[model samples]
Structure formats: C-alpha cells, structure tokens
Target: MSVRLRQATLGDLPLICRLRVQRTAWLAARGSDQWTVAGKGRPIEIFAGEVGRALDAGETWVAEVDGEPAGTITVNRRSDPGLWSPWELAESVVVHFMIVDLRFAGREVGRHLLDHADRLAERADRAWVRLDAWTTNSDLHDYYRRAGFQLARIAGPGAHGPSRALFQRRVVPAHPARTAPSRYSLQGYSGGNSAM
Candidate 1:
C-alpha cells in the first residue's frame, strides 16, 4: 500500500485525536501504559491541545494510506523544555506525536514517516532526528532501534514527563542509486517555515 503525507490543518484535529485514542487502546491491550493516565487513556482535550499547537505551527503531518488517514506525525526544531540540552536541540529535528492507526500496522507506515523526518532534517541541514519515547515502553524502544535510532540516554529525575527514553539517529544522506522514489510526498512544506 502506498502512503502519502500532507501538512495537517486544524480541521484534521479530530482525526489525529482519534488515531491517538486508538493507539492508546492498542497499547493498553498489550499491558503497556504508554499513553494512558491512571489506567485510562489520556483525555482528548489535553491531547487535542498539544496537537492543535503543532498544527498551528505547521509542524504536523497526516499520513494517508490508500487515500485514508492512517497516521500522523509532528516534527520541528523545538525540543520540549529541559528534555534536551540547547546544543542538542539546535542540531536536531525533534519528533512528536507520531501515531499510526492499528489498521495500518505492519505496512511500514511508521518507517515511511521516519524517512519523511530524515528528509526534513536533511533539508533543514540538521544532523539528527531525535525523539523521546515512553520511559516504560521497551517494545517501543526496540522498534526505534530497528528503525536506526540509538539510545542516547534516559532523562534525569529533573525531567518532567514520562516520555524520557531519548533516541536519536544521525541524518545519513540516501545514496541515489539505492534510494527508491518516495511513494509519499510532503504537501505545503516550505523550508523557511519549517527551518530552525
């Protein structure tokens, strides 16, 4: 199946929130508390607010598979305050709110989204793509490892959130000969708007 990505608009808020809730349920079923709050999923209002900010900043993208919304991701230069040293934030494109609909699982939608992040980093002249995963989600950590990320470090006690498992992968330019034409395309992406 082919995946396409487009900049997310405010109108897409409900779709993104639904994907988040779906993912939360999926994780909970697996006995993981990644996106939950006291055994229940995160409240839609709080999550929607976060996604709304990203949408307004033009940092969020929706991934569509077979012309249907399958996932969403937000990448930008701003790291959550105190999660990364200033130097690290300056040199990296931070990823957030990456969620894939369970129906699209195993279809490499997540990998394609990361590739999109890599391309965005390359275009912005950043050195790496960095993200903070759920601190207790070992499966998520392994998934990131298989996707080329290396564990940087867990945040110290001073960090405020539960998503403190830091991971980063260097931005390696894709060799032309081996690089396949992307099945996905970025819509409304402007270097000036997205650059750090």
Candidate 2:
C-alpha cells in the first residue's frame, strides 16, 4: 500500500549502507545459506562497492512506502558467475541483493521491487531477468517460483561455502502508446506497484 520505486543515485549510498547491515543481520539470524562469507559476515565495503558500481551503471533502485525507504534492489548487467545451472547465460538483466525490510516482509514490497526490475529489463531490451538465492532456503526458492521465475540451476558452494540456485523469467515486451495519454488519467498499474 502506497509504495513507489525511485531511481537510486549517489545520494542513496548512506541508506544503502544501513540497509545492507539490516539485511545481513536478518539473513544471519535465519542461518540461511544466503550468507556465503566466512564467519557469517559481509563487509560493508563490499556492499558499498557493489552499490556504487550499480549506481554508476545506472542500475540501482530503492522502494519507498509511505515516504520511507522500505526495500532495495541492485539491477545490473553484471553476470553472477557462481550459480549452478539449468540457467543458461544470456544477455539478460541481472537482479541482485533484493531485500525488503523484515518489518514489511509479509507485505508485497519485495515483489514490487522485483516487478519493477522486470519492466526495466524489458525496456533495456533484455530477453530475461535473472537472479540467485541460497540453495538451502526452500521457502524463498518457492516464493520466487510463484513470482514467475523458473529454476535454472543450483550452482555455488562458493568460497564462502553456501551453495546458490539460479532462476530466470523471460520478459514479455510491452506495447508502448503511440500517443501520450491524458495527463490526469490513471493508467493500468504495472507489476511494480503494490499488489493491494
């Protein structure tokens, strides 16, 4: 309810840094396979570097709900190299570090972020959107399947030791309006908007 996605820029670095800590802590609590670093840790510098690169590439996004930052996603052209495979590498839009604040987990925040990435990927002329998840989290894997991603492969057991599974969804091209619609008309809500 009342959620929107904004393009991420250099100004968001601080917020992204904070959210990385929150997300990493939550993942550690779950003892989920998502944590691949030795000692169950991820350096903020690493997150910062990744976010900085994505922003520089014009691929990061932030989701705000009720005027507050509620989620984050890194949508980039970078390929994830460690994922196992039924997933074939294609020229695809890659989505990484998808996180919705745990306070809003049961809500559709994560879905909205992902759907936005899907639309963005399509607009970039990508054939598919790809992502990876920890191999041990059946619940999360199932959640993605329901959201339309097909399991591609289970790669990983990376240096950090947690295996990861790859997933992908083909993007359907959207039909653009030949002429602009009325300024005040509320067009159809795309998947990037709240489900509610």
Candidate 3:
C-alpha cells in the first residue's frame, strides 16, 4: 500500500504520454468510442504538450503504487473556456487527463487518484471538482456515477470532438483513507501539504 502522488516534471514526458495512451485500447474494446483516435490511441503530441503545460503550471501529478508510476491526473482551476460557462469554471477546478494503469484496473487506483484530486480542490478553496467525460462512453459515465459524481448538463462540441459529458462532485473529506497524514505529497504545491 505504498500509494502516493508526486509532481510531474519534464523528465516525465514519456511517462505522461504513456499513461494517457496505454489504457485507451481497453476503453475501445469495451465498445467505447473514447480515445481510439490516431495510432497512439490519442493525439499524443498535443496531449504531451498539454501535460508539459500542466507541468509548467504545477498541476499535473503522478500516482505511484509501491514506487511505480501507476496513474496520472491534471487538476486545474478552470476548464476550456469555450466548453464550460463562466459560472462552472468559477466554482470549480477542472480535472483532466485522469488515467490509472490498466494493470491496476480493479485496485481502486482510479478512486484514490480522484480522492487525491478532491483533496487538491479542497485545499485550493474550490467548492467543486469537475470534469468533462467521454460522451459516448456509457461505462465511463457509469464509473463516474459510482464515484459519486453528478452529471451536470452536457455541452455541445466547440472544437474538441464530443467528449462533453459534464460531471461534478463536491469537495469534501476523504473518509477512511487516512489522508490527514497523506501518505503522498505533491511537491511545489502551494497548498498546505497536510494530506487531509
């Protein structure tokens, strides 16, 4: 149980790309049309660029299991301005590029990663943690539902295809996880690293 989060760096560029593109095949096999585009399972260079930007902004993170990188997420103060209205962006820190290793599928690694995002949102004083899920991926939507997220209204496509299934959940304590002494710490994070 050596799960923890650490800030991603330039050195982690390949790891970031790998995380986003790896489980995509699993997603496609489940009859989901999400991220099955391009040979790399996604728009790799563009995604890598986004990860680089988040790395510069200190918003990207890696979740490690027993010292191996198993997942990653990008939690930031806003969503694509064109996709979300002013209000939603104002009240939330948008979550993006969340992926757990396919190998850790049944290990609750995704849940832990999201709980960590909630903690980050709470620390940043955001009232909500929000995300735009893949529109056609019913299973992913159900997964978010099981994670306690409520479906906000779906937005029509602006530029980025139709992965606009908006979802949101409140920022609250991560019960029973002993996050108070947070087993993980995100370096360079401005918020108190108190782990709760």
Q: Rank candidates by TM-score, best first.
A: 1, 3, 2
Q: Tens digit of lDDT per residue, candidate 1, span 61-150?
A: 988999999888999877655678989977878888898888889899899888889877776667899998888888889989999999
**lDDT head-to-head 1 vs 2, winner:** 1
Which segments of candidate 2 are over 4 A away from where they belong?
39-42, 82-90, 156-163, 173-196
**C-alpha displacement of 90 in model 3, angstroms?**
1.3
Q: What are the lDDT scores of the predictions, listed in order?
A: 0.79, 0.66, 0.71
Off by over 4 Å in 3: 38-42, 157-159, 174-196
Q: Write the per-residue lDDT of candidate 3 for residues 1-196, one digit (tens) a residue.
A: 7788888778887987776667666665666556656322347677778778888877778889999998888888656545677787666777888888777776877888788888876665567888888776677888898998998877775724556778889988655353354433333434520000
Give lDDT tens digits, candidate 2, residues 72-127: 88775555455523334345666777777767777898878888876776555557
Give the TM-score (vs. native) of candidate 3. Answer: 0.83
Clashes of each: 0, 7, 0
Top model number, lDDT: 1
Residue 131 displacement (Å), model 3 = 0.2
For model 1, what is the C-alpha lDDT against the true structure?
A: 0.79
Top candidate by TM-score: 1
RMSD of 2: 6.7
